[model samples]
Target: MVTLASMEPLLPDSSRELEDLAIELTSVASRFAARLHPIMRASVGDLVRSMNCYYSNLIEGHNTLPIDIDRAMAGDFAREPEKRNLQLEARAHIEVQQLIDRGEMPYPVLSLDGICWLHGEFCRRLPDDLLLVRNPDTGEEIIMVPGQLRTRHVKVGEHIAPEPEMIEPLLARFAEAYSFKMLSKLQKIVGVGASHHRLAWIHPFFDGNGRVSRLFSHALLRDLGIGSGLWSVSRGLARNVSDYKRLLSQADQPRRGDLDGRGNLTEAGLAEFTAFFLSCCLDQVTFMEELLKPEELLNRVEVWCNEEVQMQRLPKGSWPLLREAILTGEFARSQAQALTGYQERQARTVLSSLLDCGVLTSPSSKGKVRLGFPVDIIERWLPRLYPAVR
Candidate 1:
């Protein structure tokens, strides 16, 4: 039987070299997370969640746009059935992620139950057309059983997963080594990078393993507070898909002789992959940190508001209210006229235009108005965010 020994050196050696890299990852994530206000962090997190789903699906070769995803959230799926299913899939990914963000998964993220739950929740809502996979050899149709490990063998590219019977034992060992209490905070962060490849290698389900494994990593990072709802590793991975896949494939190789540690797999390969993963995450956080600089964001918004007013797309003097909302997160309903410096009637017009454009959102018309990040304006407001809806 295949055992955890084969996957030993789950992390790299604790040499000064690996330690320095790990510290760099931890430091970068901490600094990026520290720069945002609590409310802004939540807002950015919400935006990142949408981007996360988009990139995660993109990895699966589904190219749904971020604007379409926003429309799907509003229950406006595409008219075409195929396009509509993709929208549904995107919505499902976002919904399951929201559950993870809320800490609703049943067991520790690396556990058997947690993995199964993530798979089940995601697959349960998938369109029927997507629930079936065709066997390349026999032309046999296989229906994926939600939340269940495969009852038959399968191959992914050049890597054949462990036999069906070994899935539970391997996953149990996975949970044992990776559960939160078993490692220090820093080790957990490293695990977030390392476990991603290992779980993909495990490939417990017949389908959706890639998405589930990514979601699992997302949940793990969020649980550790390293992710802090501010950034996503998925965006980083999707942007570097070629290297990401190459590293994953290289990590799957058999042990490269005696120098590769005492494991049945290569320690150097795992270390390299982990380094790449952490680096991708750091890059994403850095990009967001720069993209979200307060002055730059406010200038962009001011420019956009000015352009809109010139085009009559928005009422004049709306920039002040938008600037106030961006700075304070929200402004009182009664203060709207003062902020916009418009009369009572014009103030209502400006506020209504902002609300209509999704530049602002309120739970009710009478509730406090808060800054919104509508995807339509994201290119102008948060440029280079998720490929500009192409």
Candidate 2:
């Protein structure tokens, strides 16, 4: 088994104080990660924005850019040829749908022992040609063997790093940790972070390790307590990839021991890496949470989602029409009637149903409903849900 370096860093930075900041930062992050759920559905716009951030980061990290998700998901962008990265993203969305449909966790059941990892654990797994990551040096992408995806020296971003192993044992470790009988929020947050760092060291598969790691990271957070699973940890890691790698490398790099011929890790370095990772999570959560406050300009549609669900159910006819209006973010209730072609009362009735579902924006104090906060979120949440609505 590969082991992390001892508690002290191999090469100390000039400033000693920079590395010891974990206690203060970790405390804040741990708290935010625990509460990410309250803010997940804060807005449909937020949902799209958060996910857009993830997709963009993923593309950017690979030295490429993606057309907006809407275009790709809808097949609206007719020109750009299908790319490996986009296929990977499409598969990830399928995984999310699988979770929604299963209405439960599957990591518990997933294993990666064979050349093939989880088959459609998420709807469909990309073929090797599409899923394999490129080698930065040779500009080659590899996908021939299962183990090679992790251990094979391939390429990502600018340089070649070890492929991470999301092999059987790793998945088992995740499933076990997730089922952690004690399951406190703090334990989940910190435990997931530790798992994140630990997986990096394992360097599991030949291709898509980083991507898989983040997908699992988000999955863990959702299983723990996050509501929407919209926020992507990869966004944070990609934001400062250099610092992220630097800290992790430092943590794994061992110090030359005095005459022992064995290397030891600087505990402080590991702590620093964990701290930075935690801080990234907290920062994202804090930024997202702010969107939910009454004062900030939250996505209106999201505001509707967060309200009480206990309102009496809307009558059947009313719900279909109303849900479309709110779900589509169409302000003119009348237009809802046009889209669904429901009769006047029928349309209004369904709209009323939406209100009762706690899925409507509360009219302002003046008793008039305006499009609730980030109206944009509907664009994402609605579209994302359509396929799974069945």
Candidate 3:
């Protein structure tokens, strides 16, 4: 019964309110990215990707711990089958996101090929046990094909997906309607939210649609030069998951009356969801900005270092070198003695202790050291970024 027209109102009606939200998000994201040093930005970005992967999976009920995610990144796996599988899944999500963050994709994120790539990349790396989806109606287990459009009809809760034959045209229309080159900068930001809902409504793939949609949105924002990898909307979404789901479901409703735009779906609902999505993004950027404020962050790190020194866990002079790294983004190995006001031998010992504890890292044996957010210390360094590892 569905046709290409079924995916109507690819974008919400433009309003001053939506434009204001988009403009504010643009300004805040730019300021946040500009404030951080390049090296520090890269380090923070790596952590945000893991945080994003954690929450994106959490949205789907996969509760992989942040510690397990770090272990998985280091090529470690659990002995038990289920736990190990979840680790692999987490690893897969992070890897794919890294590729997107690095601008390695061959097609525009809103395009058909790009969406498929997102789904395929994430799904292919998943363990075989995790690729099977069982139908609630017939109790039949279906093996979802990675990067392939669905060949059979499907239903998600109260909404049924378009017929398999309609997917290609629908997706082509979806891509055209949300093309980055066609929309103005402000419109593109709004489209990120609008496309999110439309993609979910289409249900183009058999599984992983939610993740693919989110990754698609992430890439879209990055392409717009807004997603500096410094912050993630997934954290906000996961934190207020009830409202997130409610808005998404509301946006899927049919046009209520003449007051709504002339489309099969509700324009007011789409606009409402877009507002919610942008608000979540703005909230996260603001939260990260507050967390990374230079003075506050330095104080927090210094306090943790002093506590460690008092406990004899770290050498006494560790805070000075850490302060140098925090202020300068990175520091040369030879500068450590001067920074710490210690003799070369004593400074070397202090540096070694910090490295052993995973607070400082270098690319090679003698390269410049930069801040490292090892999972164990993430709570102390960046509290509430994730739940404490207890």
TM-score of each: 0.96, 0.56, 0.98
Q: Mind sharing the TM-score for model 1?
A: 0.96
Q: What lDDT score goes with residue 272 in model 1? A: 86
lDDT of 2 at 49: 40
Clashing pairs in 3: none
117-175: candidate 3 lDDT, tens digit per residue: 99899999999988998888899899988899998899987788899898988999998
Tens-digit lDDT string for candidate 1 (266-342) = 88888889888888887887888899888899999999989999999998878888887778777777788888778
| Per-residue alpha-carbon lDDT of candidate 2 for residues 182-233, written as tens digits (9 for 90 to 100) | 7545545555555565555545655445555555556555555543244445
Q: For model 3, what is the alpha-carbon lDDT of residue 219? A: 91
lDDT against the true structure, per candidate, is 0.84, 0.46, 0.90
Every candidate's CA RMSD: 1.6, 10.3, 1.2
The local distance difference test score of model 1 is 0.84
In Å, residue 138's CA in model 3 sits off its true spot by 1.1
Candidate 2 segments exceeding 4 Å error: 1-56, 59-67, 82-104, 109-129, 132-141, 144-188, 226-230, 255-265, 298-390
Residues forming the 10-long window of minimal summed lDDT in candidate 2 = 381-390
Model 3's TM-score against the true structure: 0.98
Cα misplacement distance, residue 173 of candidate 3 (Å): 0.8
Q: What is the lDDT for 182 in model 2?
A: 72
The prediction achieving the highest TM-score against the true structure is 3
